[model samples]
Target: MSISITMIIFSVLFLVFIIRLIKTATFTLEYSLMWLAIGTIMLVFSIFPQIPEYFANLFGFETMSNFLLVMAVLFSLLQLIIFTKYTTKQTDDIKSLIQEVSILKEKVKKEE
Candidate 1:
């Protein structure tokens, strides 16, 4: 149950990141790459954690290696949240600027 919920959350975020990448192809290609890498890495390890243990020990928790796994999931979640907020704010600012331009154009036409 919990695993399904987690998968759903990750899937939604992965979709959003892909959509954003397509929307802003050039400027964000690099940024999108990093997010994709993080998401892919997390998902892979979440499914098969021994892969990370083989590479390097991210943590030395007493019993549950799940400690490191949880931390990685959390870090990925934080990155996604930050990216989403940033993209939302960027869109809002662009809309505001376009509105301001239209208002200025209207004022210039009235002056003429």
Candidate 2:
């Protein structure tokens, strides 16, 4: 019923979901590791509710929620950048593969 208890439950469920994804090969280890780390951090914070409050005060935030929100936003931005880099690399690799296949097809045609 309390926020901390809810967070703890959510964190556990998230960890389980991530593990299942990894087991089923739906998510690669590299991607799952970030999620796993996030879940672990969430669990830790939920277990010790004062940790975030202490950090918020240390960082001069007006409230712990604001501090958490800022952190979540930063994490989301970092994830976006990483995924963008991966997408660009995959596109380039696909283009290279297509070019290679086209060249091979032309060679086969000439041989035939």
Candidate 3:
């Protein structure tokens, strides 16, 4: 039970889960793309275990695991920021819609 083998198994399972989510409409394709890409990259690195090590050394990481951990953290943070921005925009849009409806209701009330 090597780390590489474990990674490969988990990556495949992750990809399958993402695909199933997309198929069932539980997760939108747009959001699932990032997860799919991550899973694919994990699978690739697992199959060719040397790639991460090479990149880790090239990037001055103390170890491949450290490099992977840093990259995953950075990627997750970026995704969180993007989703936050999206949520803010949606909130603003919803507020604007509510205001418009409120104004329309007021006008209807006056007419009545």
lDDT of each: 0.73, 0.94, 0.92
- Residue 70, candidate 2: Cα error in Å is 0.6
Candidate 2 residue runs with Cα over 4 Å from true position: none
Per-prediction TM-score to the true structure, in the order listed:
0.43, 0.95, 0.94
lDDT of 2: 0.94
lDDT of 2 by residue, 1-112 (tens): 9988999999999999989998999988888888899899999999998999999999999999999999999999998999999999999999999999999999999999
Please give, for residues 4-69, the per-residue lDDT of candidate 1 as tens digits. Answer: 468657866875777676687743677767767666776776666566675554465543456666
Flag clash pairs in model 1: none
- The lDDT leader among the candidates is 2
Estimate, for each residue in 17-107, the C-alpha lDDT of model 3 and write its tens digit.
9999888989777788878888899899999989999999999999989999999899989989999999999999999999999999999
Ranking by lDDT: 2, 3, 1
Candidate 3 local Cα displacement, residue 51, angstroms? 1.4
Against the true structure, candidate 1 has what lDDT?
0.73
Clashing pairs in 2: none
Off by over 4 Å in 1: 1-27, 39-51, 54-58, 62-65
